[model samples]
Target: MKKRGLAGEFVAHLFPRVVRGENLRLTYTFCLGGLALTVFLLLLVSGVLLLFYYQPTTAGAFSSILFLEEQVPGGKYLRSLHRMASHLFLILLFLHSLRVLLTGAYRPPRQLNWLIGFALLGLAIFDGYTGYLLPMDQLALWATQTGMELLGTIPGGTLVKDFLLPDGIGGSLSLLRFYALHIVVLPLAMGVLIVLHFYRIRRDKGILPYL
Candidate 1:
């Protein structure tokens, strides 16, 4: 009883790898990707929690925000966490891409990963934009209005705006569509791209310098 062999002894071997940082590659863009991932996790946790009580309809949206602000126990904390995580994601994504470009890491072999990262960045923006609409308050309304109007100026952007514009309201966007795309499509695409991103890293770049 209580004896150990190769399997149990493996626990002893585990500590040094982590301690010596052998457990994983540590590269500049990879580190930033990890940080962005952490932020995304925070956003997800806080967002789902908010979703429990959030109402996306025009009639209920502002009230839900007030409830979050005034009634919920940790509402402010959750709001702040979500907000901060969103900002951090933007920062981290930018830094990660910039790091790759500056280091020439995106050249050959890794070019597709960089392209995928760009797509993911756009998806992340859409995710944030969709989430922004959940609040459905004046600010979110005005923001979406501004966004769509600006988008309308792009080539074929008018068609895009028409596709997203609300049927019953003159000034509102489609809450259901945006929410579905955010909670479903964009994240799914990002997840796929993320798997490929990591795979490319391992296959092409291997590990970073340990020192």
Candidate 2:
């Protein structure tokens, strides 16, 4: 109780400022932010668990996935959960983008934050594509191959094709690269963008027209 009081007193003494309801965007913005954070955390945890049992190359991936789903107890549940959460994350990411567009939330001081949101949107979709390739099932193989062909038609696709389906791609190697990108590079980039997003919010709030 004493500690609680001291903490509260410290907060009060150091920061007496109050947030006015009208000063912020509509309630929906807060709701959207909540959805974004929830989905991102879901992806992080599920992606980590998936990396434990998955192999990336074409030959072994199918068997490894089957092993996780059938042989390992509770593996089916987590794999299914991960798949569902991924779809949900994409849906909500799209919704968040729409919310910003409709609200004109990118005005003036918020324009750069809007760009960050767009980048996150693209990353979310790319994450889905990368995940789809990890299983190396017939569906994964055909879909990825078709995607590569489609990109191949576009200019400068030679560079893009390397990472999408490198020459040495097989079961274990591709999975490792996919896992590292999903868990390491993409997440790190997302984290940095999220921080920047919040920092910009604080900066904009200072100059925003108060109601």
Candidate 3:
């Protein structure tokens, strides 16, 4: 027998051969978590494609989007894929969370994974919000401004608002900040949380055996 290499060993360790048959059923966990991860990967790829033409600035943001839609080949579809994937990612995560709650998957050893999952959801939402402002259209501007104001109403929210929008929505600095968070900061944080979430699942012996 040929010995497995280090990478093969790691893969085997990550995904053991034995899994509960019930966990494989379509109705077991509904595969919501897996679907969410797939959509996230789609979003990441399409987002990178959009980044090629997207201008993160107060002056050129809207025009850059227009250029992407009208001038670049398949740019509209790429953006739409990213946008739709973002929505689907959130929806799948919400449903997955509901499934977890209903199935009591959050009990005991799995509680940490539950928190990590929710944190990923929150970051995903914030990532969407940040991307929403990148177009610099009137609607995006006003909508993001309204969101910032609402955020400010919460205690200690003003600090977050200030950090995110020091010069107010649509300002050069604010647009830059949003662009950075959307493309860089939030994605990195989400990646970290996703790794931890998966690790926890592996540590907890996977998916709670469908209750």
Pairs with backbone N, CA or C atoms under 3 Å apart (clashes), candidate 2: 56-171, 56-175, 57-170, 57-171, 57-172, 58-170, 58-171
- Of candidates 2 and 1, the better by TM-score: 1
Candidate 2 Cα lDDT to native? 0.71
Candidate 1 clash figure, as a count: 0
Which digits, one per residue and each the tens of the lDDT, describe model 1 over residues 1-211? 2434443333333222333445456655556876886787787778789888877666777788889989989898888888888888988988988887888888887788789888888888878876776677777778878888898899999887777775522233487677777677877787677666665564464343221
> What tens-digit string does per-residue lDDT give for candidate 2 at 43-65?
78987888889766566678899
Clashes of 3: 0
- Please report the candidate that would top TM-score against the real structure: 3
The lDDT per prediction is 0.72, 0.71, 0.83
TM-score leaderboard ranking:
3, 1, 2
What TM-score goes with each of the models? 0.81, 0.79, 0.89
Model 3 stretches astray by more than 4 angstroms: 1-21, 208-211
| Residue 67, candidate 3: C-alpha displacement in angstroms | 0.7
lDDT of 3: 0.83
TM-score quality measure for candidate 3: 0.89
